[model samples]
Target: MERSTEFLSDIDMVVGPRGHRRWPDAVKAQIVAETLVEGATVGAVARRYDMRANHLSEWRRMAREGKLVLPAVTEEPKFAALVVRDDVETTPDPEPRSPLDLIFGAVTVRLDAGTSAARIAEIARALNASS
Candidate 1:
């Protein structure tokens, strides 16, 4: 006697909580890239994937925003180019002091003991400008 074989349909496939389905990652990536980068309609991708259009659309958006859980193919290079030994090192600007420094006596101020109010105002302006 010959035995009959049954095959599972696309609908029979199950999707996991982590967004992985019975379909291969490469296939899923192709579908997503087609819809997002290729500008293919969601309905078209959905038909190709044998899924609902809305679901495919949501998946595409999620993939674009990096919300989908997918395995990394290769390790991306940390730096695009290597720095030469002779290259000069540039120093970054120091972080600005807190505003409290201006309010409190943290900042040193140098002015003549008998300096006029106008002179003091000018000195304060210069200090503020320098800051």
Candidate 2:
């Protein structure tokens, strides 16, 4: 009974500082990634990290949104054995067209991807002045 009590006492470990425990993005991402392993559970991972499952979930969400940088794997990634296929289309497809393109009667103004509205307006004014 005394041994059981002693063991139980040791189970509760300090999570961190008393109030709000602020974890760095990198650490959160690493812990969140641990939950993705084959047999790992959120609850178990959270407990190991001394955090709540809900908090761990939030970290996972951050990772999904690219707010956190996941830790890199130590081992090189493995590739499947290359098998020669008979009907696989190996031809490289042509690159897709620009995302933003404006055409004003033969005047094809191909805007670069992520072209700002201000730049677009400037282009429009230049075109108007020429005509």
Candidate 3:
């Protein structure tokens, strides 16, 4: 391959006081909230806004701790109308779940179908204690 080096442009970002960026609280909150959308990732949001992933993660943590506040969505929630036709048959959304078998190091815990989280924790603790 022949070596060909071309000029690449750099993004011009305004450095705020003390050589650090001074993002407004609202902007930070918006960026953090974008990651909260279904199937959204911190890396994607960070890349879209051209900022560090760590910073966005930190902002999300701050929002969780009530340090930063995200603005409420202006649009009202809308739900798609469900349509039914006599010619069409409807199937159940999900089949009934079967019993669960959890296997750990030298231990196996079989749980009844639809076991609650609290019961699972209790079983785990009991198993750990017996060992």
Candidate 4:
């Protein structure tokens, strides 16, 4: 190989201060919420967001501690109509009936028979939103 001491002058320089980025609380909450989804892992979520897993874990801890509030991931109505069977007997029975059961995926909530429709709707919406 012949020794050629020619200088290559073509060079591109990127000049910017490298520092820690400040993420908005809303953005942080959104990212944390993604980790809460079923079958989502902290490492996977962090990688998807181009962040460190430990940092995401810290944010999750903050959420648990109530220091950070995650926005509800619901796009539907907050309350739903509670439906009752017209065939339900209005007269008092000799035996107390079982509590009203609200099933959401793997979770089941038992509400009293006298529970208000609004309250039942609120509980159902909450359960549906969580899932």
- Candidate 2 lDDT over residue span 30-55, tens digit each: 77878888689999987775568998
Write down the lDDT of every candidate, Cα atoms only.
0.61, 0.74, 0.77, 0.79
Write the residue-wise lDDT of candidate 3 on 12-103 in tens digits.
33456785756778778877878988689999988777668998999999999999999897657779999977997778789778889877
TM-score of each: 0.33, 0.44, 0.47, 0.45
Clashing pairs for model 2 are none
**lDDT winner between candidates 1 and 3:** 3
User: Candidate 1, clashing residue pairs?
Assistant: none
Minimum summed lDDT over a 10-residue window in model 3 is located at 3-12
Model 3 residue runs over 4 Å out of place are 1-14, 85-131
What tens-digit string does per-residue lDDT give for candidate 1 at 10-65? 33555679956575545566556667543578887676665689877776677778
Residue pairs clashing, model 4: none
Ranking by TM-score: 3, 4, 2, 1
Model 1 local distance difference test score? 0.61
Descending-lDDT candidate ranking: 4, 3, 2, 1
Best by lDDT: 4
lDDT of 3: 0.77
By lDDT, is 2 or 3 better? 3
Tens digits of per-residue lDDT, candidate 4, 1-131, equal 55331221121222237834567777788889999887899999887666689999999999999999999887554677899899986876667766999988889898998899999999998988887
TM-score of 3: 0.47
